[model samples]
Every structure is written in structure tokens, then in C-alpha cells.
Target: MPDYKAPLRDVRFLIDEVFDFAGGYQALGATDASPDMVSAILEEGAKFCEQVLAPLNRSGDEEGCHFDNGVVTTPKGFKEAYAQYVEGGWNGVSADPEYGGQGLPPSLGLLVSEMIGASNCSWGMYPGLTRGAMAAIHAHGTAEQKNAYLPRMTAGTWTGTMCLTEPHCGTDLGIIKTRAVPNADGSYAISGTKIFISAGEHDMSENIIHLVLAKLPDAPAGTKGISLFIVPKFTLDAAGEAGARNAVSCGSIEHKMGIKASATCVMNFDGATGYLIGEANKGLACMFTMMNHARLGTGMQGLCLGETSYQGAVKYARDRLQMRALTGPKAPDKPADPIIVHPDVRRMLLTMKAFNEGNRALAYFTAQLLDVEHLAESAEEREQAANLLAFLTPICKAFMTETGLEATNLGMQVFGGHGFIREWGMEQLVRDCRIAPIYEGTNGIQALDLLGRKVLGSQGKLLMGFTKLVHKLCQEHAEHPQLKAQVAQLAALNKQWGELTQKVGMAAMKNPDEVGAAAVDYLMFSGYITLGYFWLRMALVAQQKLEAGNGEADFYQAKLATADFYFARLLPRAAAHKAAVEAGGESLMRLSAEQFAL
Candidate 1:
């Protein structure tokens, strides 16, 4: 079995050394998030994840979720763990205090979430969706709606889901067949089938609040007609408690390759009782409040699974006796040296390490922006944070997942044949990670959103929000003694990023297909440069700490080493993405639709 240990050291290094979460919280006047409180939360949260959830990962995957009739049952030990989760006051760590939350900063909440997710991705899904649902309702729900749902959901007794995907549509919400008919009581009858609903129907929570999207009778056609509705599994009575069974039912659950314990259900809403949360025909925009959160969380899935795989693989490599090193046998007494002595194995391990640590830096940096966006007192600070968040979100969701997939695959490779076995647990990480790139909007969709909607949609304004930071950092540290070369490399890459975007923009103006063709590559290119920026930041921090003679010498040294590996071995991949972006859409489109057929 893979022993999943919390990477608290790394988490702290980023929170304390890299991004300085402590100082930021102080700046935001988050009195409860003192350094001691932060440490206590990290330690306690790690204990819950490592002890409560980690042990259930393999067993849960083996047991999966059970579906009988219209009900769904999560894997064994999940409910108890969930109860412990709520009792421990973890459900609303960063929620509004008005709704029973601790009112902690967003980054702290995200750090806690990382520990939970890294421990058990499947178990995390239940509460994870609840978080997205909570965000949606909190943002769009009226006062009554908040009073009706927020407390219980925040307490973790009630879970929530966003039911958007239908049998015929996934990304295109405009063509959805779901309908909302008005009733006398001011409620609407939501009748539609929603497929791939994560946490849609589960026994873990008392009620499942589904934020469904449907078109009203007088609504306009296409996406503009869509309206958001709150359809609960169990409707509330006058007392606002879960009372009677609603019309929603779990038709079935998916048996999948990964995250089998998570119930991905096919839901049938036969005129389910639903209340409008936002203005009519504005559902898509409101739902984005949840979608963006999910996208970021989904990106964390990649990091979470990759962390699990890397942990498992590292242990296996160090302990598992393999062929002697090519140069010399490091373990002279043993039959063969440990695989860690081998170059190829080291390469695989380093790649996993580089991506995992680099991605963590990116995530924590984004979390810092999230904190500013939510808690900053100044309007200017909030606006800049929002812009940067808007720009980096797609990159976070897409880039992290893409590289996370690579990390997990590399981790599996390091284990060789043992990695393929079920009991070893390496394969499960890969399976769980496979979905990150596909769901929460596919990386391709994220690419288009980055290049098409966010970049072009904002006319380069959003892109500049982030690049300006990169330029300023490069200019300030032009002679970064230890990382002068890295600084120059990043500066050049930052310049090329804007140049390539401009080229694509020019081409897209002439032929719109240019944007489509360049999008995925452009996003990848953007991810590499973005990650490069974080890696540089980390490297600089490590250098400063080393110069200042801070303790934990080995840890800081490893950070420097990994930063070096990223710059030398990984960052160059950005060039290929740039070349693909420059290749244009003609070569891709010249082939006729008939040529696609075998």
C-alpha cells in the first residue's frame, strides 16, 4: 500500500518562505490566522488527512461506491471520516462567518484543502462539490436562500452539486433540454436529466442541493435563455430543515477506471422542486462562480494525484532492490543497488519532483491572489488580484493538470511493472489524474478560454495583468547573482510569450481558425513560462535563505536543485509549444472533413 504522507514541509516552505501567507494575512487583518493558528491548523488538518482519509484510499477504490435503486452509498469508512471532518470544523474553514464559517483567509483554506485532496481524491469529491455549490449559492442566492442552505452545507451535514451536463450537451450549455416551468408557489418545476453529476446522490450528507440550469418558458433561445435553479434532493419545510423527498433521483452511477469511490451519477429530475437563485437568463454567468472554483479544484486533482504517485514511487525506488548502478554499485553489501542510484530512475523522479513542487508554487501564488481578491481592503488591490486570478485560473486548471498527468505517468514509470499492479496504488493515481485534464472543462476548452475568451476577449488587458508582474520581477532581479542565467531565460521567454500572442492575434483577425489552432499550444506555452516564473521565485527565496544561513540546509538546497532542473530540463519544452503556435491553422484545416474518416 502507498503510504500517503502530507508534504507539510513543502507546503510551509511556500506559505512561509515563498508567498508569505503570514504577512499577507496580517495585511488583510485576518486576526484568527496568526502564525501559531496557521501551524495548528496545518498540523491538525494533516493528521485528519494522513490518518483518517489516507488509509481509506486503497480500500475505498477497491470497494468503490454502491448503488441500489435510487440511492447511492459511498465506500466504507467514508461517512465516519466525513463526520470527523465536520466535527473538526473543517467544512467552513474559509467560509463567511455569517454562515458558521471560521472566516479564515482563502489561501489557508486552500492549503487545508490541498492536504485533504492529496490524501484521498475520491473522498475529497463529496465535500469538494459542496464547496463549489456553496460558492454559487453564496454569490447568487438571495438572503432567504442563504438562510435556507448555507449553514448546513457549511457544517458539512448537507452537500451540494452543480448539475449542468446533460446527455446531449457538456460544454455547450445553450442547447440543454432541461426546462423550468413556473408554479403558483413561486417555485419552478425542473424536469431534466443531468449526467456526470459528481456527488449528486450520496448517503454521506443529509441533503444534496443541486444548482441546476434550465430555460424558462419566456426565456430567449441559446445560452442567454438559461437560468440557475436550486433543486434540493430533500425539500425544506417551513422550519427550513430537510423534510420531504424531492423529485430528483439517482438513475445510476458510473463504474470507472479511477476515483471509483466518487459517485458520478446519472440524475433524473422529474419536475424537481427548484427555486431561482439569480436573475433570469443570467444563469451561465452565475454558474461560472462555481465553475471557476471547480476548475481550480480540478487542477488541484492533478497535483494531488501526482503528489500521491511521487510519494509511492520514491519509497518503492529507494527500497526495491534493482540492478546495480552503471558506474559502480552503491550498495556493495546488497545483491544490487537501490534504483535511486540509477540515472534513468533519477530522471523520472526529478521530473515528478520538478512538476509537483513547481505546480505547488503556482497554486499557492494563485491562492495568494484569491486571498487578495476576497480580503484586500483597497479597491485597486482587489481589481488587480481579480484580473490576475482571471488570467492565471485557466493556466492553473490546464497547465497544472497537463503537467500533473505527466508527473503521475512518470511516477508510474519509475515503479516499472510493480506500478501497474492494483495493490501498489501507483496506477490508481494515474487513473484519478486522467480525469482532471478531461473534466472541469477539458484542457482544450481551458486553452480556448485562455486564448479566445480571456486573452482576446479582454483585448490583451488580462494577459498584461500577469506579464507585467513577470517583467517587473525580471527587471528588479536582472542581476540575481545565483540565478542570473535563469532570470535572463525567463525574461526572454516572457518577451516571446507576448510576441507569440500578438502573432496569433494578427492571424486570428484574418482567419478565426487561427485562434482555435493556436489555443492549446499557446496555453501550454503560457503554462511553461508561468511555471518558470514561480520556479524562479522559489529559487530566489531559497537563495536568500541560504545566504542568510537559515536552518534546514538540505531542504533549501533541494529547492535550488529542483529549480535548476526545471530551468534546464523542463522549461525548454515551452519552445515546442511556441513553434506549434507559430505553425498556423492552414496545415490543420487543409484536410477535408471526409479525410477524418478511416
Candidate 2:
């Protein structure tokens, strides 16, 4: 297994050069997050992840988490590493200052999160889920609730989880049978079983705060009846410290294909005391606040795993000698040429490179939007940022993860037979990444959300808003000699994206199933073009640096080369998706459920 290293250069490139995040921070009134401060934070974050988390990754996978008699024990070193993470105040990097947080921009937190996730995804889960829970409480919880939970949670002395899935329900929360009965003390008694709860019962924290979803009595049926509740594993005393154990207990932990170190538990709530969050019958909306946060984090998991796998693949390719380069002997002194000398190996490496870098840009861009949404001074600015976020969230979640899976598999393929073995740790990445596309809402559901709700539901306004940005970029660089061709490509795609949406919208209006059929393909198409815009932006910047004779010539040149490879090799795949979107729903629906079998 290769040592996991954070791609600090690429991260800094996106934040400092491509995105102008420093200027963004100043504009957003995040004065504390000056460029120096941000850089320091990133450097410190990199150290913690590299030194503490990376070493635990394989050991965590091998040992997994232990669950016996409702007690959950994390893999070796996890508790101590988490302690260091807490002591460093990593968990509350972006939480509200009133709750003992650093009060930095969420984007800065996301930057650090990407590094931690890449080093050890399983170990990251404990705090990752906590952040999601914090978002929910911050967004929807009452002031008293926030005071009771946020401080300790933000301190990382306590961890949190979102409990929504039941034994019979996953995505369809409308039919959830969990009951939240109103108690005499105004608290609710939550009773039912929640399944697939990540970090649900870990022993690394003083308490586990669960934001549970249950239906209140006399509430409307289906999703409309659902209400959110704060159910802690241990009931808190009047002093706001963990007290008696709650009725909630881990029934069992799942034996999973990967991420075995992260406990996926079946939680049984037997009249667990829970405080209602938000208004009754509006729990789904509140849950989405956390869900969206989790979705973006989940998307980054794709990039994280892909990056780790890419690092391993690149090292192996450079060291593992097989045959001579097609052109000539690149490593003449060796027994044979290194595999990295081969064109196919280079192709695989570049493919992984393009996706990893492109996805990083997308993630960071979305993070900027999040900063704007939360901290923008004006209502219009906030609303505009929110609209764009709504439009891109599904795309980022689905496309990045879908492509992330491809990138990880490519990493394995680059390793050939050795990749399949567990010792190499390449297969671990493949196994771990498999669940990303499935969880946090399946990619299929994300596609439908993108095409059906966000795109057409808004009458193409959301789609237009993003294309307008792309259009502006093209317009700005249209006259540049070096960037003209790339700008032209983006302009063409910008126009085509609008046209494609219009076509899909028109078809779906007549036959709604058309949206379902074209959804995934349309999303992939959008993703490719979306990435194309970022690649061009990066290339334009790299070209400027080169023209100025920047000292980091290799870095800028590589950026330009990767952008060229993306445009020449990867971006063209959008055409196939365009064709598939135009194929309509007939072929998909014609095959009935019975025809799916052999």
C-alpha cells in the first residue's frame, strides 16, 4: 500500500489560483480566514491526517469495528486518533463561534475534510457524521437545543449521527414506522429500529447525538407526517452532561464488504427520549439540511478514494517493470522498462488525474457557493447562490461519485492481477468506493432530482443560471490567443447544454417518463461540460503563469497538459450522453420488470 499524501498543491491551486478564495473570504467578511491563516490551517490539517489517520486505514479495515452486547469498540488507534482530532479542534472548524467553534468558512473546513477522508475514510466517518448532525441542529434546532448539543458536539467530546433509515425503508421515508409519542414532560418517546446508521454506536465519543426521524401521533400519513427528533445515546442531565443511558442501543453492526472499520449499526429505540426539532410534519425538510451536507461530503469521498488509489497506482507503475516503451527503452539500465513508460499506463494515469482534479474544482466551487449561501450580505446574493447550489448539489453528488468509481477501478486495472489481492490495498479502495454511489441517495435518484426537480421543475432557470457563468467565462477569454479555442469549446457546450435541457424539458412535458430515461445521461452530460468549463479556467490561468515565466514552470505546464488531456480525451464523451438523452424513454420502459431476469 502506498502512503496516503494530501494533494496540497492541487488544493492550493484551486483555492488560491483558480477560485480566488482569499478574495472570496474577504468579500464574505471572513476576515480571520486570511490567505496565510487558511494556508496554515491546511498545512496543519495535512499533518494530522498524514501522521495519524493514514496509518490506521488498512489496520482499521483488517480489524474492523467490534460490536458485542450493544457495546461498540472501534479499531485500534481510532479512539486515540479521534482524541487528537478533538484536541486539535478539527471537528468544529466551521461551526458557530458561540458554540466554541473557530467560526471559519465551511469551504475551509471542506478543504481539510478532503484530506482526512482521503487518508482514512472509515476513521473520518465518526466526525463526518457529527458535522452533518451539527448542520441539522444549526439550521433547524431550537436555541435551547443548540445550546444543549452544539457546544459538546462542536468540541468533539460528543459525536452525532442522522437516523432516518428503518428496517423496511431506505429512500422512501414516507412509510417509516418509527413512532415519536409526546411525553408528559414535553419530550417525545421515540420507538422503532433504524438501520444502516454510520458511526451510530462508536465508543470514541462521550455521547452519540442522533437526529432521528419519526412520525408523531395525529400527524398526517406518509412523508408529510414525519418529524425530526434529537435522540442521544445517553440522556443528558440538567447540567448538560451525559447521564443515564437512553433506551437506544445498537442491535448489531453490519459485516460489510468495505469500510469495515466504520460501524454501520442497527439501532433499536425503545421509548428513547427525544426532543422535537423544527415543526411537526416538516422533518424531511429539516433532514435535507443535513442530507445535503452529507451528500456533498459523500461526493468528496469519491475524490478522496480516487486520489488515494491514484497515488498507489502511480507509485506502482513507476516501480513495477514489465516491458519496454513502444517507442524505445525509457529505462535502458533496468531489466525492462517501467510500466509507466507504456502509453496505456499513461492513459490510465491521466484519466485518473483528470477526474480527480476536475472533481476537486467542482467540490471547491460548490464549497464557495455554500460560503455565499451562508454568509452573503445581501438577500439577492444569498438567494442566487442558494439556487445555484440546489442545481449543482445532485450533479456533484452523482457525477463525482460515478466518475470516482471509474477512477478507482482504473487504479486497480493499472495494477493488473496484484490489484485484486487485499494486501496491496487497491481492492480496498474499490470495495469502499462502491457504497458511495449507493448511499447518500443513489446516483439514479440524484439523476432524477437533477433532471426532474431542479432542472425542469424550475423551468430551466437553474440550468440557465449556471450556463450564464460558463458563458461569461467564455466571453471573458474569447479574444485571448491561447485560450480562444478552449473558450470556443466551452461556448459551444454552454449553448448545447441549454438546448439539451430545453429538449429534455419539452419531451418530459409530453411524457414524464422521458425525464426518467434521459435523467442519468443528461446529468453525465452536464457533468462533463461542467468539468470542461473548470478545466478551461485552470488552463487559462496556467497559460498566464507560463507567459509570465513563473518559477513553478513544471506545475503550470502540468496543469495545462492535464486540461488539454481532459478536453481532448474526456470531455468528448459528453457527446455520447447527449445522444443517449435524445434516445427517449421507449427502450428503457419497453423492457418490463419481468425481462430483467435471465
Candidate 3:
């Protein structure tokens, strides 16, 4: 197993250099998140992740979680690691200050989260789900609900879970059968079974707060009738301490291919006490507040796994001897040259590096938008940021995970037979990363959301909002001597992205299936272009640093090189996606469901 190291340098580069998070913080009134404060937080976050979480990753995977009756116990060392995580105050780094949180910007929390996730994804899920639940409650919960639940959750005394999926329903929530009935005290009895609930039942925290979705008695049919509720595993006493065990119980824990240590439970809420959140029949809207947060975090998982895989692959490539380089013997004294000397190995390494770095930039940029959306002073600014986020969220979730899976697979491929062996730990990454694209509304669902709802649903305004940012960047750098070429490339792609959306919109008008067929490809295409813009920005920054005779010439030069590789090798992928998107829905729909089988 390879050791996980936080990419602190690259993280700092993005936070300090590329994104200007300090300036963003100032604008957002996050006066406490100064550069010095942010640096200290990141450094401390890195130490905890590296020292505490990384060691348990493989062991956790091996041990998995043990389930007995209704109780779920996490793998050995997980409880201890989680204790240390809470001790370090990592859980509420970005929660509302009014709720016992550190009250840092969401982006900073995401930065720390990236490290935690890469170090130990299974352990990270415990708190990751909590953050999502907290977001939902904070956004939609009543004052009493927030005051009662937020503090314990922010204090890390209790963990939270979003219980949406059931044995029957996955994405199509309108057909869900979960039922909630009002009680004498105005609370509701939530009775349903939710499956695939991560952190649903665990001994790591004192209590589990579940954000549930169900239907009220007089509810209208379909999605409009759904309502959100907060159902705890153990109902709180008058003193706000967990007292009587609620009707909620873990039916069983799932045995999975990867991320086994993260308890995926089948939670049975049988007349459990639940409090309504937001409007009576607006549960889906409230749940989306959590889902969007989870979706972005899920997208980050791709980058986290990719980063860990890349680190392992790079280490192995540098040390593992293999056939000599094609040109000549690079390691003359050794039996054979290290695999890093080979062209194919270099290709794999570069591909992993390109995606990892490019995705980081994209994630951080979106994180900044999240800050603006939450804290900006002006309504217009917040609205603009919200519009951009709405457009980018699906792309970020789908593209990053798809590319992340690619990067992790390439990492394993670079290892040959050794990669398949579990002891080497490469295969575990592949298994762990596989679920990212499948969950969080699946990449297919995300594609439809992106193209159908966000892009075409708005008549291309949402997309244009993002393209405008790209155009502005291009215009700013068009006159620069060294960056002119990259600027022009981004400019052309920006124009083409809009045109492609229009073409797809026209085809979708003729046949609605056209949207579904072209959605994923369209998203991937947009992702390539989006990353292309970020890579160019990074390259331009590196170019400036080089011109200024910076001491970190190697780092800057590598950034420029990766940018070049991304454009030359990866950006062309967009062309293929575009071709498929232009192919329309005919070929895809022609195949009968039965024909998909052997």
C-alpha cells in the first residue's frame, strides 16, 4: 500500500495564486479566513489526514465494518481516528458560527475535505455525510430545529445522514412509498425503509440525525407531495440529550466491493419521531440542498482517489525497474531502467497528473463561486454566482468522477499484474472510485440535469454565464505574448461550446430522447473545455512567475508542461464527445431493451 500525502503545494498554489481566495474572502466578509489563518488550517488539516487517517485506509478496507443485529461497528482504528478528527474540530470548519462552528468559508472546508478524503475516504464518509445534512438543515430547518440539532452536529457529538434512496426508488423520488403522519405534538411519525444510507448506523458518533423524505396524509400525488423531516436514531430528551431509542434501526449493512468501512445501511424508520423541515410538500427542494452538496463532494471523491492513485503510481514508476527506454538505457548500472523511463508509463503518469490538477482547479473555482453565492453582499453578485453554480454542478459531478475513474484505472494499468493484487492496494482504489459515478444521481442523471434542466431549460443562459467568464479570461490574456496561443484556443472552444449547445437544443426539440442520448457526451465535452480554461489560467500564471525569475522554476515549468499536455492530449477528447452529441438519438434508441442482452 502506498502512503497518502496531501498535495499541499498545489493546494496552496490554487488557493493563494490561481483563485485569489484571500481577495474572495475579503469580498465575502470572511475576515477571519486570512492567508495566514488559512495556511495554518491547511497545514494542520494535512497533518491530521496524513498521520491519523492515511494509516487506517488499508486496514479499514481490510477489516470493513462489522454488523450485529441492529448495531454497526466501524473497522478497528476508525473510532479512534474519528475521535481525533472531532478533537481537531474538523467537522464544522465551515458550519454556521451561530451553531458552534468554526465558520470558515465553504471553500476552505472543501480544501481540508480534499485532504481527508484522499487520506481515508471511508473514514471521511462518516463526516462527509454529516456536512451535507448540516447544509440541508441550515438551509431549510426552522429556528428551533437548527438550535436543537445544529450545535451537536457542529460539535461532532452527533453525525447525520440523508436518507433518500429506498429498496424501490433511487432517482425517481416521485414514486417513493415512504409515509409520514402528523402527531399530537405537531411532530410526524416517519415510517419507511431507506437503503444505501451512508453513515446511517455507526458507533463512531453518539447519535445519528437522519434527514428523511416522505409523504404527508393529505399530500398531492407525485413529487409535489413529498416533505422533508429530521428523524434521529435516538430521539432527544427535554434536555436535548439523546434519550429514548427512536423506532429507527439499521436493518443491515451492505457488503460492497469498496469503501466497505463506510457503513451503508438499510435504515428502517418505524414510526420514528420526525420534525418537518421547510414547507410541507417541498421535501425534494430541501433535499436538493443536501444533494447538491453531496454531489459536489462526490465529485471531489474522484479527484481524491485519483490523487492517491497517482501518488502510488508515480512512486512505483520511479522505483520499479522494467524494460529499458526506447531510445537508450537510462539506468546503465541497473538490471533495467525504471518504468518511468518508458514512454507509455510517462503517458499514464501525465494523464493522471493532467486530470488531477485540472479537476482541482475546477473544484476550487466552483468552491469560490459557492462562497460568493453564500456571502456576497449584493443580490446580483449572489444570483450570478448561483446561476454559474447551477450550470457547473452537474458537469463537475459527472466529468470529475468520469475522469477520476479514468485516472485511477490508468494508475492501476501502470502497475501491470501487480495492480490487480489487493495487497498492493491499487485495486481497492478502482473499487472505491467505481461508486462515485453511479451514485449522486448517477452520471447519466447528471448529464440530463445539466443539458435538459440547467442548460436548455434556461435557453442557454446558464451556459452563457460560464462562457462569459471564459471569454473574459481570454480577453484579459489575449494580448500577452506567451499566453496568446492558449487564449485563442480557449476562445474558439468557448464559442464552439455555445454553438454545440444550440445544435443539441434544436435536435432535442424534434425528439426529447435526443437530450438523454447526447447529454453525457455534451457534459464530457463541456468538461474538457472547462478544464481547458483552467489549465490555460494556470499556465499563464506559471508563465508570469517564470518571467519574474521566481525561485520555484521547476514547479512553474511543470505546471506549464501539464497545461500543454492537457491541451495537446486531453482537450481533443471533446471533439469525439461533440461528434457523438451531434450523432443525435436515433442509433441509441433503435436498440430494444432485450437487444442489450446477449
| Candidate 1 per-residue C-alpha lDDT over 529-580 given as tens digits, one digit per residue, 9 for 90 to 100 | 9999999999999999999998889999999999999999999999999999
In terms of lDDT, model 1 sits at: 0.92
User: Which 10-residue window in model 2 sums to the lowest lDDT?
Assistant: 481-490
- Native-to-model Cα distance after best TM-score fit, residue 257 in candidate 3, in Å: 1.0
Q: Candidate 2, residues 1-598: lDDT per residue as tens digits?
A: 6599889999988898889999999999999998888989989999999999999999999999998899999999999999999999999899999999999999999998999999999998999999999999999999999999999999999999999999899999999999999999999999999999999998899999999999998989898999999999889998989999999999999999988999999999999999999999999899999999999999999999999999999999999999888899998899899899898999999999999999999999999999999999999999999999999999889999998999999999999999999899999998889999999899999999999999888998999899999999899889989778778877998899999988988897799899999999999999999999889889988999899986799999999899988988998899999999998989889877988994
Question: Which 10-residue span in candidate 3 carries the lowest summed lDDT?
Answer: 480-489
TM-score for each of the candidates: 0.99, 0.99, 0.99
User: Whole-model Cα lDDT per candidate?
Assistant: 0.92, 0.93, 0.93
Candidate 2: how large is its RMSD? Answer: 1.0
Task: Compute the lDDT of residue 168 as modeled in candidate 3.
Answer: 85
Q: Between the candidate structures 1 and 3, which one is better when assessed by lDDT?
A: 3
